[model samples]
Target chain A: MTVKLYRYLEDAAGRWPDKIAVQEVDGSFITYRELDRLSDRMRDRLVELGIRPGDRVGFWIRKSIDAVATIFGVLKAGAAYVPMDPTAPPTRNNYILADCGVAVIVIENRFEPMLIAEPSAQGAYPAILVIGGAGGGVHLRAMLDEKDRHAEAPSAVSAPVRPEDLAFVLYTSGSTGRPKGVQLSHLNAVSFVEWCAEIFALLPTDRFSSHAPFHFDLSVFDIFSAAKHGGTLVLIGEEVGKQPLELAHLIADLEITIWYSAPSILSLMAQFGELESRNFSSLRFVLFAGEVFPVAHLRSLVKYWPHPRYFNLYGPTETNVCTFYEVPTPIPEDRTEPMPIGKVCSHLEGILIDADGRAVEKGTEGELCIRGSGVTRGYWNLPEQSRKCFVEVAGATYYRTGDIAKEEPSGNLRYLGRSDRMIKKRGFRVELGEIEVCLYRHTGVREAAVVALADDTLGMRVHAHVVSKDGRTLSLIEMKTFCSEHIPIYMIPDRFSFHPSLPKTSTDKVDYQTLKFWSGG
Target chain B: MTHESSAMSIVKEFILDEFLPGEEPSRLTPTTALVSTGILDSLATLKLVTFLEQTFDIQVKAHEADEEHLNTLHTICELVDSKR
Candidate 1:
């Protein structure tokens, strides 16, 4: 089996040239043959521009066929694709670009607003290849059109890239600092994809619906896992997500066989009663991750599309996937509690370590650590940070997931809570300290402490406890508006509660645990 | 006034009960913002369309699933009645 992401596509193209590889929401479909040809053209263009293996190429575009092409094309050119969400705040985008040190960025002309909004992007990259057309001041599609498609592909692309060589750098949040890029090798991704295909029993006839954005790790399973089995990958637009009725219609219209997304989407669907309305006869598998799946939510889902096998996936972007549990038995009628993350996936070993870093006994809570091919190499450009999380054990390495979990008597793993202060809201990792820093940056704010408010509707909403100077009152809407300019929509605190002074621990650090209770859970 | 009768009323009641399971009796008005009030998320909006189509036996088109028809309880009930 090919270790590279592009190689998987090429293998599929050779095996099923005429088969549909990806179908977009606009009814535009691309065959495996077309995908290979287009990818080759992009690769030729990248090579002509002097981009070689080991060079970082940022795919800063919205979800579309073009984004997928950039990922495959980057891999084909022996380069690593760093996906940057177009909707991300300009500062965050700058942080990622600066941290990753990418010389070039592949973006859509429509998304040039990010470049226009950020003054730092003026000279951020040496070259910015706009996908569609010439937006402002950047290289246009002429570069792609002028490429010699007939030219032989680079045989000696990068030094025979080992499974340990960095494949892609996925940027994820740290508890008290800027997002760090996780360096995952081709071997790490390939192994995870292989296991994913097997666990789901994916068939060539399966049409996997893609909803998660490119930056998110969940989308990796949708793209690579489908390509691995020569299955069809359907790209659903953000509009489909914004309008769930359209999403329901698309599932039936596109004949989507495999469905995987965050639990929020499914919970929302179950809330609206859309699951019971349509005949999703084509769907065979459904998986949810990035958060704890509420039992009541999953039950509502099964009530409609009961035929598909339901699965709860657990892992961090640092490790593509470590454990998953298929809902083998039907959920009980009175399931008020959340479902467990269940067992580890095949080809991986999981251990729960307690506070003292010793293996915990069965049924005892501890930090979940994983050792396998799926564990990423380390964080890119952050050696000091990388050494902190990735630790050597018996001469081998394991990634500390920072998630608290417990091992059942039957060896199944149950997710408890986060060992760190980091929180997952609507699948986007938010650093409470980072939010606090943003709050402190406000001119009117003297000091701040951000806390999470538990709401069943929108997952976890942020509430900032602040002490403003001169007793000036700050409105929640005004603070949210200010945060919107500095952070992504998901990171914006839903509520702001003013305080005289933050409650501090003995060591003078903000008492987050006490503040969590003060935020009314 | 097509849905003013007992038979149609039960359908509306069922729609409210299934969609807003734990909603208060006092809040089950003819018009309530289901989409805006955190009652429906992206998936719930889709599931609502399918649920209406199956329960009312009408194929709801993708484009028609916009806020005009599915945003509010009254609008959804009206759309279902018209389609039926």
Candidate 2:
């Protein structure tokens, strides 16, 4: 086995040089050999740009063959890639760039204005490498063209990447209103990839759909597992992923064998899309994670597209994927119970522990703690926050996943809810406190509280209740406009309610339970 | 109100009720850019699309869901009018 992550691409190229490795919905395709060569040229360019081992590179490009090549090139150059959502608010992307101190950023022409507009005051902004179109930054195409003109193959001086070296830093919302970057090592990512490749029985003939964006950890499995197994990876763009009927058609047209995404997306497709009328003959495996799968929707999907094997995976961005549950044959038609998160993946051990660090009895719910090679190092640059989650227990390090779960007698794990106020809204993990902070940042707002309301479609919907200072009032449009400038759109509350004064506990803290009850959430 | 005005009213009401409850309807004009102003995200846009289809009895093609056609209230009204 290779120690570095990019070695999968190299090995795949050697084996299936002419095989189509990745294809976009618009019919653009990249063969294994072409992918390998492009990434090699990109790696050479990075070396020439003085990117050393351990340097952080940022990727804010759209989902394309070039984006994939850039990611592999960054990994090959022995640098960690920080992927920011291109559609995300530029302020949020700039915050991540400043936070990680990225040495360079790979971007497309469309996103140039967004990045150029938000100049980092902290001096952490890196040099930009434009993928297409004429831009002010270093044109990536020109660099590759220059390399091609030389007629000499770049030296094969590969960066010496070890298994323990950092592979990527994925930023997620922090409870403290700022985003925290989770540092994952090559070993951490590879262990999860190899386990998935084995568990799913992937083959070179299998065509996998990359439904999740690069920023989401789910995409790690989509991109790498396909590369590792030499399977064809179909890149599903954001626009197509949103259009349910279109996505359904593409799934059939491309003959995607492995389908992986958040359960909510699949549920949306089933609800709005003509899923029941469509033919999904080529699909063999359907995997979902990030949120609970509503049993009713799952049943409908199983009935509609009957060929695929169903699975429910559960994990946090901190740990790529620690637990997985395979849907049993003949799903109960009337079953209403929440599906079990099931067993831990190989080489990982999870325990339910109480607040005082004591193990909970079977059938009792407690915070889930995972300890193994899959556990990430910790949050980047936030030592205090890192210490709060990653702790030494019994001389072994364990990541305290804020989720509460109960251990079944059959050794399966049942997810309860978050021990903290963190909730998953539209398959994106959001901290209510973070939204409240954004709300309070407005001058007209005096007090604010954010809560998650359970929704049948969206895993959860955010609702914000506020008490204005004096007689001042703020409209929802104004509040949303203010928030859009500060936070990502997904974090914005779905509904807003105003109160004269917020209820408080005896301790003077905002009484959230009372708010939840009064609001009927 | 005529059919176009009623359709516009319904669209504005839905946006306000879901995204900005209790806000004045006048704040959102016929030219307000829902998509550009960050009011309708991917999921929210889908919800709006569903509402248009069910309420107006119009089919919203996947290609017509872009900002050019569905971003502003004017374009949305135009789309509904054209489909109807």
Candidate 3:
């Protein structure tokens, strides 16, 4: 199989040359032909900069036509792309760059600060490549100007990447207190896309709106599925993301047929009353994942747009999407609790395993393990951590998703919670250890334990209970500002409290449950 | 800003009916703190913004609806009036 993500895009161009492949909030449209031409030019420029086959490149740009073009261009140049969210802290961004050992860094000038905040690229890479300006290393705009826009797609490299070759690395937080890069291969991703398109009944006329960033795995479904079937992809601007009303208008005005995003985002839309009087006549599918969807909110959405089929997609980034369950029809009266995660997808196999690594019988709870085409290869550059989760079963590897779940007699999977201390906030993985490390780095902090607090206002907020060293007092503002430098802004504690000492268990381990009680969560 | 006209009553009812759900619309006032006061949380804020935009036929740019504008019912009413 070809290792290029662009093959799908190229096919779309052939099938729909005049169709709008992407539409920006500024009203600028990138037709398939233009996307092909621009990506060709960008590929040539990357080649000119010594980017070779198997080299890892990166993209830190916002959601735009350039982002879509650059993703295809990197694959066209035989390089895998790593993405950095611009909203994330500079330190986290720096760590990902160093860990991936990315050969080339491709980012717009506006986001240059995120890359340069650290001393240097500490991994197996060279200089950064700046787009839209100069002064970093190679000026992408200048290189593009010098390249041939009409250049033909480069011939397949002599060593064409196999289906198992790494296609991209997505860095996510782990329970071990560090970010791990999940290595997804071409086969792993394209297979998931094929399964999704088939199961969802995607068609060429489907106009999909992308709310998640390119870095998020959910974007894979949007981009790959759209490109595979020559479907229209309407790119929502950052401005639209902050204002739910603007996003609703974009969806309604564009006549989007499929909507896929985090449950929190959808809840925001429903809570805003945007779903009350709006008409989404063309919408036929609404897919949500990343966090649990409250059943009440789901009912409200169905009330307004009853035509669209609603599906709760459940999976970790390591396995793109292994399980899905459509909400029951005739809407049950007792759906106030979180909905069930349901059975495995058509191409995946799932089972619940207890602490002894033995399969638990029906109605028994255990960690959910999945084996499927969508399961990622493993973490990049961390063999030990990879070995811990990806276990060989029946001569194939199965990933331990760490989500505690139970298999009912009906084979439906119901979620229990995390087996570890990690939590999900705003759809980003968060580890208590990561927050504690940030707290320890502060000057006046002697010891700290970060606990997640459930707040009705914000789903979940991190609360840090700290003990000042030598009677030193640290103000909330100071601790917040200090944490801003060490960790991503989202992982920082929203509310801080100073404690003399933390409650400990009999084994001397930090009693997080007692901390949770103290937190009033 | 008196809840005198039936149009004002309708808008008030829409806010209470949609956001507060079963609560009486008469209890809600134009000066009420729809968001911070627990009347409307983040999700309700989204619904309120959408309600205002569609009912008034106006586009609410993302940045314009910051904390100051969305925090209270009076502020939201002021924002809607300005947009109108």
Candidate 4:
């Protein structure tokens, strides 16, 4: 068995040297042999730049074929790659880089000023490698070309990376006014990928759709599944997300055989894509996760594209697709409740524990806990927070997902929403407190509270309550602009309710319940 | 004002008031890249569509609500005028 993910790519390159491995929306592609050589060049470049094993490397560029090269190259150099969301506010990305101690980052020329000017960019700056355009950093496009290498094809290079070494770090919404990095090792992800290959029966002929950003865990299944199976990865630009019809056309046009993304996207295509007019016969498996699949949308999608098998995958960033439920064929029309999360994956052991951390009996509601090779090591640089979520029971360490569920008579685990204030907005996990923290950063704000407004169409919309400084009333537009500069655009509040003072609970904490009640649920 | 320019001003005013509340008014010209620059997300685009439907009595088809037609104030006005 391969010790790291890059080795799988090496394995694939050895078999099918001329086969396409990754492709962009423009239809440009890189074959397995070319991808291997390019990644080796990237590894050689990083090594020349002093990137060492266990170091953190980040990429602030958009999703493309070169971005895939960066991932494999970083791993080949025994470093973990931190993929940043380019659309996210640069301040947050800078903070993430500083927090994770990124030794280097791959960025485009246009983003250099923002990264340098941001307040979070203080301290020792990470070396930047520019692609596409000129920046103050070294131009990376030169080395990516095969012309710089020897005439003869170079064999695949393997680093001294161990199985337990960190492979990647995903920054998620943290409760404490910032984002937390969820670190996963090669062993942690390999187990999940192997399980996925076995469960879905992945084939080299399958063309997996890559829609999610590299930062999202959903991309894990998309990127690795193709490399592991020696299949082609089709990149879909995020711009198509707003144009559901275009998204539908891309899926059909790309001939995507294996599809995976948040259910909201599938719902969007079904609601407005006019999918019946298009062809989706290429899809063999369609996996949706990150939020509940509204039955109405699922039914409409099936009505249009029924060729693919549907699966409801459930897990947090800390646990990679821990449980899944294959949607039963011909969903009953009268069914109102969403489908259960189904059984845990074969590689993991899941248990339900009470408020006191004791295991609960069958058919009883409890917090879902997973202990296995799939569970990721907790947040980077956050020992206290990691200690809290990852607890030991009977010598095996389990990750507390903070999700409530119960085992049904059919032996399936049914999801019962979040046990805490975390909510899914457009299939992305968000902490209400994280928004409040951003609002409080503004000097114009005195007190701030955030609550979620659940909407069927967009998963959930954020509603914020604020009391401005010195009795001044803050305009909704000003708050929106301020929040947009500090947080992700998706995390922006849908509405702002100005208050002279916020109501408090009996314990003196801000009354989120009252605020939620005021939002009319 | 001419009908095209009148429609353009109304749409631009609505966008500034909604998506770019505190920004300078001169920034949102008729040719400004609203959708491409992410001044309008899907939800924001839907909101703009709702406002236009009620104000101008024009329906935006699912295909019409894409980057090509909805990317700028000029194209959006063209879409509104065409639908009308």
Model 1 agreement with the true structure over A1-521: per-residue lDDT tens digits: 66877788888999999998887777767788877777776776677666777877786777766767777877877778898876677678767876776756877777666663222334544467776642211133344653334454343342355666667888877655477788888888998998887777788899998988778888889999888888988987554665555677778778898988887777766665366667899988888888876677778778778788988888888886688888864677976777778887777777877776677778899888888888876888778877888655556666788999987777788888887778887776788877877777889999888888656766777778889986666644346556766766667665567778889999999888888899887
On the 0 to 100 scale, the lDDT of residue A505 in model 4 is 93
The per-model lDDT (C-alpha) reads: 0.73, 0.84, 0.74, 0.83
Residues A215-307, model 2: lDDT tens digits: 899999998999999999999987678677788889988999999998888887877678866678989899999988888888778878877
Q: Which stretches of candidate 3 lie over 4 Å from their true place?
A: A1-4, A117-127, A133-143, A146-159, A394-396, A453-457, A470-473, B1-63, B66-84
Index of the highest-TM-score prediction: 2
- Tens digits of lDDT, candidate 4, A385-426: 999997666677789999999999999999997888888876
Which clashing pairs does model 2 show?
A: none
Q: What is the lDDT of residue B44 in candidate 1?
A: 56
Q: Proportion of native contacts found in each model? A: 0.17, 0.42, 0.07, 0.12
For candidate 3, give the lDDT.
0.74
Winning model by lDDT = 2
Show pairs that collide, candidate 4. none
Interface RMSD values, listed in order for every candidate: 7.7, 2.3, 11.0, 4.8
Residue A31 lDDT, candidate 1, scale 0-100 = 81
Tens-place lDDT per residue, model 3, B1-84, is 553344456567776566554444555666654433334444555566677788877776665665577765666666776776
Interface RMSD of 3: 11.0
lDDT at residue A429 of model 2 (Cα atoms):
79
lDDT of 1 by residue, B1-84 (tens): 444454346545765565544444555555655444334444456667767677668988767676567755667767776776
Candidate 2: C-alpha lDDT: 0.84
Error of 2 at A94 (Å): 0.6
Superposed Cα deviation of residue A251, candidate 3 (Å) = 1.5
Name the docking class for model 1: incorrect
